[model samples]
Target: MRAHIRSTSMHPSGNHIDAEVDVRTLSVALLSGTGRMGVHLSAAWAHAGMDVRVCSRRKEKAQQIVDALLSGQGYSTGQIMVPPHPCDRPAPSASWRLQAGRVEEAADADVIVLASPFHVMWRTLEPLAPRMRGKGKIFIDLTNPWLNTSAPKGPRGQTLPPIPKAEPQASVLFHKTRFNDPTSSWCHAYRHVFWMLIHPTGPNPRCGERLGVELLGDPRAVAVCTAMIKAHGFKPVIRPGGCEVAPRYEISMLGRREKGPDAPPAAGSDPDGLIGPFSASPLIAVDALLEKAARHFR
Candidate 1:
């Protein structure tokens, strides 16, 4: 919708002069820029005065998101500069701009946030693990992996089992693999429960901006990110050590499939929506997570 492609040069040989922009334009490159979380993050960054570069398999989709950002907040008019000319491509004679290209964007992004599913992380990040590390970058993992089941344990009817292992151990942890087992009778026994995963958006609709996230990272980064996530009308929980306590802490916070734990009891029998853990949203859970994380550091 809005095009803001500027022409500049890169000094690859160190002899030529390419204009250096001010730090006001904090460079960002979104991997899955077309998704909901990606779109939201892009807008959030722009509102904070950061320059964002979103990437998608479909260049058209990438441009479309750019347009949405402009209309939603009325700040940017930047263009989506890519290859395979779709009429917007720079002319063949156009000079190369020194703006950090795609690879550099990935490697040097100030904050590399992952709002994608867990599998996406396992597939894509596992490969880029080497370059994704270092200082000044935040790799946000907003995926909740969960599942519930009943097992034959000593007494107490039935008990939850252990999930696969993970490392670094956040103050609050998450494990994904242990949820594959079939549902046990204990869960089915209380079948008359109603679980509604409704957004605070409620009836007014516009009042629904209260969404949050769970942050697990360095202390300073955790504090900054906690504030960052909260600014979006959501809660922020700092997960200490992040993956360190992953296996032991993941229980109830997230499920392998969906619905966190189970519905509240007062409703009775007919469990509604995705029945699982967390009566509150991820934002709240992350807050709870941060508390757990802080203890780890202590």
Candidate 2:
């Protein structure tokens, strides 16, 4: 399947598919870059040379991360710009950047990567979703929400309401996910699908630190995304579960078929888990993943 490309004048299904930017330079926004993991990912992207905007709820924390990266080993020595307070309004000159909020940062970004947890993403995105619709941007969701709780509700997000029991997936090795509704708005707005899943065999998905983008959505978009992610220091591969259900299948992998020691409790034999890390081989991982996922290329 090809990428559903469009511009400011056409919908994903409109007459704008022919003319689309093939992702030259990406303005990447990491939602909660102040946190440990978020900071690490932002630093990695910066180190890899992508124009990035790292945002956090607090200004100081965000600056702290940028400072550490600029002065620390995150970025190559003298290879990056480390400005004081990367997000000072009016846009100052800097290497490592900081953004006080996602809205402003997203305005210049081609791809916005959500580093916030599952429960937090909805609240974080609700106010911004409408403004982001048809921005022709790609959103990378790294939040692993428990299914019963934080799945997106209502398509197009016109209702933009969070579920009652929808809660955060605190760091624990157990507990099944509480999946919420699937009528997700980004499904259409930003053209999202599943990427990567937990394993039932050797290891789980490394908590929140998986290193590959297991694309399972649009073939063209996934292919394009793979090259971009590869440029940004991540292994990119297409996964088996495609169609629109890849995201849900990913959620399911975390629960049934126990994998590693952290597998969620289940009955005797729930089908082991899903497949292992699709991007493992580095040599043939991309080819293998794409070959398996190709069937869903509608």
Candidate 3:
């Protein structure tokens, strides 16, 4: 995508900066950079020409994810990727750069995407929230409480983290308890389905499809986030009734899935062997989501 720098806003510190720059030039910070959604988003935002910072509890882990994103290496099966030349270095971009950082630095970005698991969201946001105050940053919640079920163990047989107990109302609970703030713009988005986040190499793999992403939050915040979501290659569906009814929309979308509404898709369901089923569920119909979103707007 071409970098388009449009509009500007002065920093709260009394300096001129493009803090309110359009999506094409927006800077993004993805927390849990090594997590499933974070890794994909880091690559997608970087490919979209946005300055991206991938943060992790351990800076080294963040660095590893960032390196793979920039170098296009070590991606797991089922992800649509364009691997880099074996001996070639990543071509530097004049408009964007990807970095490995911590939550403190991430909070200062134009867009802060919370991709950590829902069970850990509050803990993750505790320290970072204070730093984002009065910054006009947009916080996009990508965390979903996985239906209050026990998570399956990893291949090594280690038990995974349990899903958040706040099942159907996870987003509502999140905003009410930990993330509500008047200083920064925040919303629950990209939580219902994220299969479109695939193919981070760019050229918008689902360009013509215009997959709809349901967003619930402050109007001003949703508008800004809408632009960014569209620029990154998805249609933004603004759900009415603000954050209070976030759970309604979340349930509406998930319930419309062709298969596995109560549980997530099976891992490795993507025949191409790129991203896992949770990230890119094969049965998720983009057209159906758009249809449902259209009904909401009516």
- Candidate with the greatest lDDT versus the true structure: 3
How many pairs of residues collide in each model? 34, 8, 7
TM-score, candidate 3, is: 0.65
Worst 10 residues of 3 by lDDT: 266-275
- The runs of at least 3 residues in candidate 2 whose Cα sits more than 4 Å from the true structure, single-residue gaps closed, are 1-24, 73-104, 147-213, 219-221, 240-243, 252-298
lDDT scores of the candidates, listed in order? 0.35, 0.42, 0.58
Worst lDDT 10-window in candidate 1: 184-193
The C-alpha TM-scores of every prediction are 0.45, 0.50, 0.65
Q: What residue runs in model 1 are displaced by over 4 Å at the alpha carbon?
A: 1-26, 72-104, 134-136, 147-212, 239-243, 246-298
Q: Model 3: clashing residue pairs?
A: 77-273, 77-274, 78-273, 78-274, 78-275, 79-274, 79-275
Query: How close to the true structure is residue 234 of candidate 3, measured as C-alpha lDDT?
Result: 60
- Would you list the clashing residue pairs of candidate 2? 81-95, 147-178, 147-179, 148-178, 148-179, 149-178, 195-214, 257-272
- Model 1 lDDT tens row, 1-298: 1112233332222222212323233455666555544554555544444556666556666666565344332112222211111234332212211121232245466545544444343444444545644343444454333323212244775543332334322212321112111210000010110112112111112223322233343333343344344433444433334333333333233322223354222111122222222333345445335545554574
Q: Write the per-residue lDDT of candidate 3 for residues 159-244, one digit (tens) a residue.
A: 66443455335554464456556666667776654443444654234333435566667554566666666665665666566666
Error of 2 at 176 (Å): 23
- The total of clashing pairs for model 1 equals 34
